[model samples]
Target: MSIALPQLKSIKIDKFILSLFSAIIIAFLFPTGAGMLHLKQVTEIGIGFIFFFYGLKLSFTEVAQGLKNYKLHVLIQLSTFVLFPLILLGLKSFLIGLIGETFWIGLFFLAALPSTVSSSVVMVSLAKGNVPSAIFNASISGLIGAFVTPLWIGIIVSQSGGMSLGDVFLKLIIQILLPLVIGLLLNKKLGHIAKKNSSKIALYDKTIIVLIVYASFCTSILAHMFDGISFLNFVFLFSAVFCLFWLVIGIIYFISLKLNLSLADRITATFCGTKKSLVHASAMVNIIFANNVSASLFLLPVMLYHITQIVILAIVANRIGKRTLNEAA
Candidate 1:
């Protein structure tokens, strides 16, 4: 007898859902093996290379032109590096008693990360906005994140009694800065090569990101990150995060409309200004946590937030993109 299985019905899985699955499986199923410790070192080194490759792909020509659009660039960067962090900090007063220092700190870290590369660009492109601006802003955000995100984490965690300022700077420079600078200096040559092999390079880029996702979850599981986290507390934290992001997106949209920017510029403001990067989030975790429980569990909020943002933004982006395209036609 031949048996047939039902088709998986094109179930739309968001990036966050896939990432959350990876995080949970790593935390609960695998736990920590001897191999996991070694993987951490490999993960850090791999992340550096990831940024290096990022440098390789950047076109100086694009950056030169992107600089001319300084007003837009500054707006995106300020919204990402400044306005967003304040909101996360403001929540700390309310969140500390409710979710404890771990969740609060993790949320703060998520706020501090730069705007994302892939999703930000994709959303902007779909809405028929400034693709070149998205690319320029995302790349500049990553470079600054190599410093700002870690610096933000280091300062916050110190008051909470975890990592040191000097330690964080060292890791940021060596793990992130050095490679990125080398890649930048060599970009003119490397950029052409990268363009020629863009598809192959993306495969490598994805592999590195998957390794980071797996390692972070594995470490969290090994440390029993959920040990003291009650189900109710988790539920509350999730609700808070969902509300926080939607509010920010709405506020950005309203402000852009007030600014009277074109619909395309407004779309760029909403997408590039409101999102954070998973790649940078995972990398910054390496700089913050020194011990097991603190390091592993501290990563939870950002992990969860990544998924939440993706799922929500997917619906919003689709809706906005369609309307914008129809009007243009």
Candidate 2:
């Protein structure tokens, strides 16, 4: 099950990452255009469609099958939702002073996010891991996050005069939960279409994410929210993100080993547990912080962590795959 080293080396930077940054640059240059065009309303509609496609593509049978491995599921889910958030919360006192309150909140948001669906499964498969469990954990994590992320963020925002927890939940029901439920309800009929055109759907998802990113930055830039952030602050922010990735990876690996998981399950746990979804981040930020002009500021750590996870996990998965092949041979 070894992937070719050459193929691993060929793993280029994700184009979507480029698009994300480009959206930011474009937002900076033409900050007024998004507001002028009323892109906020457009992106909100796009967010609903994103979740609908998510529900459309999801197969309940596969999820049910994955439920048999309760221990594995529990570990991965806890790592994603509980362990990650707790760690950041524990470090909050130190991090806020070092990275600033806004950036720390961004990091907390990153920690609170769900495991990325596509990349988590892909990395597990790449490393010859328990792909089924990865798929299940990745999918379920998002559903869990839809509620949990709001609550987690609610704790912070509630104190700061942001949206009330009740309001956030209401918005989530309308924008995320309802659309997802509709997509699921129609899954029997339209699921094949979603599966058949997954690539197109993924493209659409990224397109919406780009639009959201652009619009968020446009709002922030117009308000000059980033003006106070110096270059040194960015250096500190990136360093914190890099360190945070490894710290979580190390803890997840240790916990997997302690759990005495099979190698395949360990790979699944490590990979899935460590992932954070930018797609969810984009959509949720819009919904959860709808009125916050500083919404884009919260996305900084998320974008940084997204890049960090992809590069680091690709290399880790490649090494593990190579080792597995060597041992088999």
Candidate 3:
């Protein structure tokens, strides 16, 4: 006799994405109390733990194996740190007019950030791609971005009389790099516990991210930093973010073909190279632009792009996975 099986339903919306928007909305309606609660200190401590857990879970063996694919690594890193920012720089004169100077800076901040570690690896694995390389690129991208992102932002912030470049680096070393190093040092003893409870850790991370978002928006809302922005401007911003995603995807696909990359490597490169980490963006914004009341403005593109990449890549990854399965059959 044949047996009936349950079919899985596709997820149309991510709960975490909804939570992000909700955080913004809550901040809008109730913009007070974040400061009174000392959320800055809370988020700062949370950011340290987030990176600590990130380092704890990172496997040295996987990183070593991923290093074998030097060409692929170089391609992904260059696309992330160089090509993305250069494209934005080239378009700055035109885009800055449309989005306004402040919002344009936000987009540049998004461009300068690193790949999302969890989603990149998950998508690559889903599409039957180079999982190890995705993990390596995603991890290393964040580390590289800790230095590189600030340099990119420094160019703009320096002009505006924001934090000095030296101060930025000093803060990053204390807040981000130091915690990461400590976690790595303890990895040999505590890595397994981190791996075992990764889901819980991820939930903790997301909670902290939501808290950061809420806190930032609260500050901005109270300051009326968004008063000048209009509905039309938001439409334009979303359109620009969408176009940026596909533009980078197209460029990466073309380059992958020209480089004669394997199907798996192509998938890894495209996915990893196009993604930007909201986690890193949230953490860095607080540290890098700490004194700026309009710091939440910088998160706009990062949040929008985070949603865009997740929704679009989920569909694309599933389609590619099905195609690979059919070909194997």
Residue 225, candidate 1: Cα error in Å is 3.3
Q: Scored by Cα lDDT, where does model 1 land?
A: 0.75
Query: Which regions of candidate 2 deviate over 4 angstroms?
Result: 1-9
| Candidate 3 minimal-lDDT segment of 10 residues | 4-13
The CA lDDT at 56 in model 1 is 85
Assess the local accuracy of residue 149 in candidate 2 as a C-alpha lDDT between 0 and 100. 94
Q: Write the per-residue lDDT of candidate 2 for residues 50-162, one digit (tens) a residue.
A: 99999999999877878899989999999999998899989999999998998888888898999999899998999999988888899999999999999999997688886
What is the Å distance of residue 196 in model 1 from its true position? 3.7
The alpha-carbon lDDT assigned to residue 67 of candidate 1 equals 71
**Model 1 spans > 4 angstroms off:** 1-11, 14-20, 34-37
State the lDDT at 220 in candidate 3.
96
What does each candidate score in C-alpha RMSD? Answer: 5.2, 2.7, 3.3
Shift in Å, residue 209, candidate 1: 3.6
With candidate 1 superimposed using the best TM-score fit, by how many Å does residue 206's alpha carbon deviate from the native?
A: 3.8
Residue-level error in angstroms, candidate 2, position 323: 1.5
Tens digits of per-residue lDDT for model 1, 97-118: 8888777877888788888887
